[model samples]
Target chain A: MNINRNNYEAYFISYIENELNNTQRKAVEDFVAMNPDLKNELELFGATKLEADEKIIFADKESLLQKNSTKIIAWKWNINVWASAAILLLLLGVGWWMMNQSAVKSHQFSEEKINVKSDSVKSSELRIRNSELIKTEKHYLAKNNFAKTKRVENKNFNAKIILPETIDTAELPNSWTSRKKWNEEHEIHVVQEIKPEEILQVQKNVAEIDTIKAVAQNAISVPPTKKTEEKMIAQIPFKTSKNERQILKMLAWASSKVLGKETNNGNFDVSIGFAEISHKQALQDN
Target chain B: MTINDYNFCVTAYADHLFRFIFKHTQHEENARDVVQNAFEILWKKRDEVEMEKAKSFLFSVAYKNKIDQFRKQSKVNLVDEFSAQTKIINEHKSGLKDALEKALNTLPDIQKSCVLLRDYEGYDYKEIGEILNLNESQVKVYIFRARQSLKNYLVSIETVL
Candidate 1:
């Protein structure tokens, strides 16, 4: 009954495992068979071992078993849906910008045509107003000529020339008095017929006024006044027939002070006159 | 090995490996997943695995898979439901079974696994060593210590009673 510690340990484990050599296995079997204490110990060990194993083996069925692949597939679907939503949002944003740009372009396109039409209508109105003013001027000139011819025919010219009893013409300038006396002595007769000489005179005046008015309109969009233009023109380098070198020397000196060292012969500054407020102001400045 | 060889491995070892993992993990679902993943990995690498060594291969795969699962789940520190489970089983136990279970849960994980492989599965020292990734001597020591711990705990409970 007394087994050594080492042998007992070996036998204890081997006996429990049922892995002893034939003879050794039989010996331990016989010993446990005869010894009740050893048998009881074996039984307790066996029971404890089995209970522990059973508890471990008693796993929850749901936790151990793999669930269906549906949950994982659903996660994949979530990523796909979000990606599609982002793409859709980007497309919508681009489409909205394109639509707004198109609308603005179309609005500007229509506005340009309306502006062009309004400009043409304004020019036509100006032409009509000019013609009306010309017609009124012609009517006033014809009536004055008719009245003057009637006075000459009725011998009433002297009666029309009746002077004031007192003369205090000192206040009037000599230029104004001379102009008035000339007008009284000679009638300015405008012939109703289309005379070639009269047409030539009118054409010369028209050419001057027309060119000046065109220049004035062009310079109205610019900054300075007509006096500046005349001053600039008077300062242009011109040589008389007498001494070209002297004129040139004078011009060079003047230009150095005025036009600086811009001595290039081909370079010329053309000055165009532009009017400002009134005829009286124009004469006063001259 | 072809997929057929892989499938054969699955049919042969899946249930056994699942049962083995179930015993250790004590959760049927975790056991199933561990086995399935082990087989899946084996299937993926069928070309590399020898058909003859399929059992050891599956067990090793299952072992690694189970360990990884245990470690991952441990991160959240799932409340040790084992204590509550022992409490419930304790109420139903008429005798030493209650004391034995409480003592078993108290043992360290390796020692408990070592004892379970030896006693319940009827594995020898070498077999337990292979299952637990321990040497025979280490397995022996673990089992002895585990049994001594259980015995001490049970005796202590008796003294208290």
Candidate 2:
């Protein structure tokens, strides 16, 4: 644009602002030189440019600086401490797993196969059908020629456990609901039939044994504290077949013990099909 | 930016930053507070900000802080005071430098910012716009108006002298 009087103010402002190129700057300079009257206006424009004062320093420059933060980032733990903590955590984890497994195994008690074998001597079978353990299921030997059968009455059971002499593994119920159902339905009756047969004559066959203890009638005492009494069953010498051995194994898995160490002196006069034997019964010497 | 780069900024730009803020606030303490706060924020965000952009980042933060302070105190117009100072200066016939300084003080807040950023920092129009959050045209207009006001003040003083 031409530097005329009307538009000189805009050119002058641009000139002082350093916004004009060399050509525009030289034009404005020449325009002022030609008309000495405009020189005063150019001088006013020049005075408008403010210079930065370097003397005005921020006194505390050190305050604005940041440290490298090396001190706060330091970790005091050694390698041994870290390794010890890791090992402790691992041990705690394994212990918790083992305890959980044991608890899970106990719930599946009824799922184990029942022990069934024929006895040569005339004996009766007892079934405490309630899935829940009976606080008291009396097994007392008669002083005379008698067989006593005590039935623990349980009603409102819907599931029955499948019981037989021999069972197919494939046909066995797999689900816990079905197993729990079987246990609930087949719930009742304890029949102990001990004929004038000796205890030695009876086969050591477990139908659904959790325990077997010899209790004499005259020797009735306080209720046994132990839910499981392994020492109660008389150690009668009886030969076991493959099926019987399997039954013993299932009994061992159930009771955590298969054979009894203790023996009673009195001979039984009746046949017996007993389960959950509590050896806490009184021992009578014949 | 590294701590060294940040420290460098502190040593290099702190004085200019203080000067820029001090001119606007006119309160040395408030200006110092704004500068300190701006540096703290810059240090905190140093990882995100590039080394080249650190200067602009600091000025932007300080500018926003100054605006917040202005809003808290309301628009502090010194027109009456400026006129009184101008009257006193005319009577005394102050030096050109002193007269120009007083003329700069009498400008509008935005005009002062535009002119200070342009002349003090030697920033081009676009850079001024980025720092002050204004368009290039707005910055140019502000600068033009500021220069005109300063020159007019100077001319009147020159006439008196």
Candidate 3:
């Protein structure tokens, strides 16, 4: 701790800074007092210790802090906003999916209801037609016994009516009915001498009946046999005398040519007959 | 560090950091720039810097920026130094404080920073070394040399007076 002349520079710095203990401080003071040359040097070194100027101050203190905090807040806010937007989009997607599912379900339900209604309407029509057909057959059976039933074949008629060999008719109808019904039952076999207009009308009525029955039955059911029967009946028009039938057949054939081309299944024979009549005058001119 | 701790650092150490940088840089705008940059760095790394070590961190950052500024202005400083010398020579005799300020400009940048940190801020040799990125012995030597130079400059001025 003794401050010698050789090591006095180190002690002088320490002593001026008040870093020395009491014993060392006293030793340095004693040494400086003894050496007049080192005293001025130590005083000059002390003058270098400058006080901080009050004018040298940071002016904009809060701006840096404010800018930093604002950036952090903005980053956090952006993350929150994006998360909320994503959640909202997900909710909208789920809602849209649910709505689409309900729409499909309602559409199927309505289709099923329409099918049910159509089936009921078709069944009622079939019942009424079947009853009428049975009554007509019974009346014909009674009349077949009273009259001498003649079996005549017409090649033009495609439907072959195979009658029973003997009619065991316990019932008899002696009264006469309308000519239209009689004509319908026996025209193709016995009464082969009908007017051309009457024959054409009969063929037209037959086509219309077939069309109505086929449409009603085929609307919901797929009975292949009924469809074939409808087509055959529609194709075969009633026949008369050879010359008259030939003229009518020629006329029918000519009219049928004007019908649009037949379907692939040949199911449009009825349209051919009407097409033939409308073009008859043109045919005669030709 | 929390917000409150960061604010405390700003309030407590801003002026001290500014004075330290100003002494080294000698230009008010450069010193202010260094102080602001240091605070900005502190705020960005607040989570990593401890509340107690914030003052040390600010000083270290400011010291580094002051050196960078010096490097950028090195060419300009050479020209300015001549003008500054002429001004000092022609100026009227001021107090010891003005003489000390002129004397500080004569020291090298490292020596000036070391001496300023030691004398103005009262940082010990180890602390000064940490701020200046030097070893304790290097900081000690720089401060010693700076003080000797200041002493010589002051004595010559007094002789002229």
Model 3 agreement with the true structure over A1-286: per-residue lDDT tens digits = 7678888877887777677899998888899889988788889778888777665567667765543466788998998899999999999888666544443443344335434532211110111122211111100111121111212232221211211211111111111222223223323223323344553554453344344334323321321243433332333333344433333332232234333323244322222232222233223323
**Which regions of candidate 3 are displaced past 4 Å?**
A67-79, A86-286, B72-93
Best-to-worst ranking by TM-score:
2, 3, 1
Taking all chains together, the TM-score of candidate 2 against the true structure is 0.55
Per-prediction DockQ scores?
0.07, 0.33, 0.24
State the lDDT of candidate 2 residue by residue for A29-139, as single tens digits. 888888889899888888999988675557677888887765544433445677789899999888656544443442233223222221101111222233332312232
Candidate 2 docking: what grade?
acceptable
Candidate 2 regions with alpha-carbon error over 4 angstroms = A75-286, B71-94
lDDT of each: 0.44, 0.55, 0.55
* Worst 10-residue lDDT window, candidate 3 chain A: A133-142
Every model's TM-score on chain B: 0.65, 0.84, 0.84
- Quote the lDDT for B122 in model 2: 88
**Ten-residue stretch with the least lDDT total in model 2 chain B:** B82-91
Worst 10 residues of 2 chain A by lDDT: A269-278
- Residue pairs with backbone overlap in model 3: A255-A276
Candidates ranked, most accurate by DockQ first: 2, 3, 1
| CAPRI quality band, candidate 3 | acceptable
